[model samples]
Target: MFVKLHFEEWIKNEPGVSENTKELIDEAIICYRAQAYRAAYLFSFLSFQNLLKERMLVASCPPGYDEEYWKGIQSELRNDDKWEAKIIECVERERPAQIFNLSVDTKRQYLYWKDRRNDCAHAKSNKIGVSHVESFWLFFESNLSKFGVGGGKEALLEKLKVFLNPAFTPVDSDPTSIIKEIPLTVDSADYLEVIENVYELTTVDIFGPMKTRVWDEMFKLRGEFLDQLVEFIKTNQSLYTQLLKEDPSKVRFFANDPAFIRSLWYEMKMDFRTYKVIIGLLRHNLIPREELNEMISTVSSNNNDTFFFQVEEPDLLVLEESGFFSEFKTLAFVDMKINDFNWARENRNIIWHLIIRNGFDETIVEALNNTMSNSFIPWRLRDSILELFEEFPKLKEEYIDVNSRINGCLPDKLFNSN
Candidate 1:
């Protein structure tokens, strides 16, 4: 039996493929499994040509595609005898900056595959076999990315600015599809530019949906297109550090991903971003579970800087509004050592930071739940913690007694009786 072909990023599933093209791919897959190598090669070769024609049909650009040339190509594609030649014409006529650009050898391979397909179609004795079918699949899979527009990352981002902006973007444009195009457009060198532009758009008034929903696409990037991001991080390591520090929610997609974290674990410097990433992995109950405690301890020593942001009050407000400091406090409270809530007793300043910023969150409530002792409760949070008794049902204050006189929620009595 033929092993299932893996293209990693779903090259076979490119959008806008014609129904005939889709069926052709399916037929090719079936024939390959049946050991009918010639039949598979012919079907796949036809589908590849048809898929290219379809991508050209729908493919438009910023400065725009040539309607006259493309419409002629489209008209020719409707004819049985002329379409294959027209598809090749489109590939050749397209400039180095628009449509798919091919190298001298790659361009030669296109014709080479075409001739091989002719041998199968005309029943010429070229001896088509399993290797031929597999080689065609491999070639098609590797070159799938070259099918997009050609001006490189600059053109890609220019198009993206309009695509992401609700005002400039077409009403029919799908953000998800545009996201998939990011990898298709640029290589690893331009990945950070892509992220920074996307981040800028999130601040646009009409782009609110992009802000919340971008994490979904970012999740996709981290999964299928993670190599682009991994390379981006390798080159711009400090930017990620700053972004993770300035607004963890901004880089939450990367910070929260265990695979992304574990992949870059040793390569990364021990900074606050490292602290945040480790906390994110811990909070989500992700892998390398036993190593996380030691990981936290290692970075925590370097994380003792007084201010989370290295800026003045006014500039700090911007980062604060973006929910940056909250991640720090959240990380600050994550005690991997037996849920030591008493650590808060020593770090009283973080309690003030918590109250002034976002108030008590789940981590606070969770730590309080671990022990019946109110020793972790401080003077400032006394009234507020009591008020939150019923906020989260599962973590309701039923676990802690606020009114008890024995070791009560009073200011002076908030400490351990022992």
Candidate 2:
């Protein structure tokens, strides 16, 4: 069956989209129909790139940057070396923090999609699957509305409409519907029923035992369900508090599910309301600290490299206070790259404590040595290293002598002390 008619129309008529871009989308549809999934992805990616470039070029140029100057920059984007850099520059310039609600993790995901598009275009060994294409499409669709780029809200609503069952309206569209279905008084049975329904949606495999058209629809439904649940909790705060007091596990499902947790973190990374909910749960001992640690472990094991680091600053502090840092330190220092090492150095007290308490593990020592040897390493890290050396005097002389020879002098602290 065709993906969805309204979605196709939405993409076709998306403002600022060119006729040539429409042709690329049409080709993508044709390839998808033929089961040429890779080709379909490539064409869709091309359409997405063209539309993005056009939008960026129009919106991002500085007031003083005349049409001729804009044309010169646009021309440079056609070059292989210049394309990604130019796009990043445009995005940074136009969609600064106030305008774009994207988090560090989301921005990284965007760059990753761009890299995947390059793989598709340049015949890289990386396989382009249906899931990858779906991810790219979903990200673009959501952000289009998020950034308010040319009727994005209407476009998003139209797209969401395609996935929704005609008989059932989205919860956000009809507030009274949820109130009727979910019940006003919060009995245990009602709470359990609501939790069960939301859990099923969160855990459902989109590609298994379901038609392709239902996939996007289910995702939208789950999101709407979450919104309704959050609202219900807010409206009946006393009831939720009572229920949570009786059984915190009811709310723990959000933290327990890695996919759900990551999605929530990314979507509301900037919002305090969600953080309040999580912190409340933590304070009430609803979600065990060990559970949070396990969640981080699970995410790490699943190869989600950035989720933990992307946690908002306040939440990061909460996680640290809850003993998540012990678990974090195990992973952070192992093969620590410069960026991560620097991050650790910023939290030097925690890192130093973990190092000293754990005792001089060879891996950490090696990582420190590597950090010290890099001439470009930040002096803060070097100072931290020297402090670390002071704590473990046995390794101090050896490291000092070696580092001194490498850098031609001791770090200022040691050099001046003498």
Candidate 3:
């Protein structure tokens, strides 16, 4: 039988999927068909969650994410302040001691990146050197090997197959592949039906053991990393909170606290928030760009020159009130749009290639998910996926089928596909 035909049959026995949720599955499939893996991945995951929530089987959170998961996110946010403090002192405010406290490696990368950024910003007539060309090629080469066109995770697995045991194949596809291939023509039923479906899907599911194992490993690592971060923040909260509470005008205090300064500097170099805040300050006219650079040069010179800004506790309060750091608390998702997912002139054709080649599997699913959240996806903006499923039906049925397969049971078809 054709793969699509098997999918349809599987859907016939799927239990618990609401019609509305089914629609989301269908839409994800359609997105897959249209070669919009980014949209497909996002929508599929959404459909899965909404379905479970409808059944009252799971909370309204992403798969593999729980209350602890959310708490961990909060921990990260608090720690984000340390990095913010560093950027404020070193880059935007040009506090010398802040720059000196940074690790040697960080200082090196920063200097290199800053020079390039400055040249571009000033529109300097800088000569493009051979090294520049080589850097560009190196980046392209690394990405090419990572996610080559028509090559998703499965492809990546194939390349790594040689080192595997007899029972392990690099190209082993996850049973979840079934979920990824849902067409874009189903609609979700009301919340009740959706929840029932999700619970049923979660139990007795069969995405090959190898595939499941790999996915499990990935999630395990992700959870562990998050746990480590949260623990670090909890342990260091006393120091960081104090720094954050201090006045930006009284930057000298940060220099006096040697241990705090060391930890704060390390956090700044690693956290994205510090850089983001610095960028935001420049973008929003909070600080003069030249003045910021001068601060960096000063910090570079002495690494502990804290007399630059006598920042006060009120200054820290002002920043917090401005939404400078606590922006990632809410999830921002929307229905997928072709225009939103496309990049450059060849996107349409690229979509065609991705779609016409047997629908999306795990690799394609990840690619689509990555694309949905690509840096180009915009800030404070989330891509919509729920609506996409409501726009499709056949795809939804396929999603239910996959879930049913995983559960080792028949899938339910709420709507007549005939």
* Candidate 1 ranges beyond 4 A from true positions: 5-23, 61-65, 68-85, 94-99, 124-127, 150-154, 161-178, 183-219, 222-224, 234-280, 287-378, 381-418
lDDT of 1: 0.56
> What residue pairs clash in candidate 2, if any at all?
none
Sort by lDDT, top down from the best: 1, 2, 3
lDDT of each residue in 38-97, candidate 1, tens digit only: 999998898888877665554454244556755665678788899888777766664524
Point to the candidate with the largest TM-score: 1
Question: What's the alpha carbon RMSD for model 1?
Answer: 9.8
lDDT tens readout by residue for model 3, 268-298: 3322123332333323434433344443322
| Candidate 2 residue lDDT tens string, 1-418 | 5666444666764434579888988898788777777888888777766665655444333334566766787787778677756765654454322223345666677778778877887899999887787677777655543332223223323333432333454423432222222211122223434443333442433222222223222223323344455445434444344333333334553443454434432332322133344444544445445477654444333322122323455555565566655565566566363335445444454454455445544455555566555546656556655677777886565555555555544434433433
TM-score of 1: 0.55
The global Cα lDDT (0 to 1) of model 3 is 0.33
Highest-scoring model, lDDT: 1
Q: Which residue pairs collide, candidate 1?
A: none
> Cα RMSDs of all predictions?
9.8, 25.8, 36.4
**Which is superior by TM-score, 1 or 2?**
1
Error of 3 at 36 (Å): 1.5
The lowest-lDDT stretch of 10 consecutive residues in candidate 1 is: 409-418
